[model samples]
Target: MKKRKILIIGLMVVGALALLTGCIPGDGSHTVAKPAGFFSGIWHGWIAPISLVGGLFNKHLRVYEVNNTGWFYDLGFYAAVISGFGGISLFRNKKSKND
Candidate 1:
């Protein structure tokens, strides 16, 4: 019974993720006179999770800008991604040797 319950929950989670994946970064193509730069990339990276959720309901919304400054934008985006998510591990409490 426990295994069946787990299986159902797992499937639900996977289904939700599959649905959400449609809104992932770089999936949309838009044309803009002014392309996003490094700072915009940083902001976009920080708000990526929110954008993903928003994008699902709003087709116009996207996690990544289609018009951007290439390498600089990519660097800023990746830097923010690594720092924002990966930095969370830095604050975790470590187990004491006595414990």
Candidate 2:
């Protein structure tokens, strides 16, 4: 029963995604604004995983911008990637009375 329920839910989610994808209107000429500057790079990096998934379904979508301010954008993107992937723990309070 549990397996059947899971399968049904998965199918529903996939169907919804297909429907949404179908709703995207255009002759494939819709251009998404690429992320620029440090802040935008950070934001894009943070959402990179999601962007990657979205990009898989839409050929026009990109996970990272091609044109940016170089080093600053790279730095921000690295920072965001590190922070998003558990690097924030480096600044956490590790001293607990119990330990």
Candidate 3:
């Protein structure tokens, strides 16, 4: 029970930190020399859950970058999003015949 409590507190702290430091999706208008690309999309997608929660309190935050490499960025974003969530199911414990 103590371990569970510590784990929960640790997770909360990590989550709070992530919310405070995670990237914010935007139009990229401020960066004229470079636009977000595939790798950026992947990173954004990975932290999207935290961003969503942060967005609720901060109106300036967004979920997707407007200025990007188009399809490549979209592909990376979708790939990460799918893999991040889908990978969890892959670890499910299957019933053994003995059980």
Note the Cα lDDT for every prediction shown: 0.77, 0.69, 0.77
Q: Which wins on lDDT, candidate 1 or candidate 2?
A: 1
Give candidate 2 regions above 4 Å deviation. 1-35, 89-99
Query: Quick one: RMSD of model 2?
Result: 6.7
Per-residue lDDT over 52-88 for candidate 2, one digit per residue giving the tens place of the 0 to 100 score: 7788787866766666667997898888889988787
lDDT of 3 by residue, 47-72 (tens): 77777877788887777777778899
Error of 1 at 58 (Å): 0.5
Ranking by TM-score: 3, 1, 2
Off by over 4 Å in 1: 1-31, 90-93
Worst 10 contiguous positions by lDDT, candidate 1? 22-31
Candidate scoring better on TM-score of 2 and 3: 3
Model 2 compared with the native: what TM-score? Answer: 0.55
Alpha-carbon RMSD, each predicted model: 7.8, 6.7, 4.6
TM-score of 3: 0.67
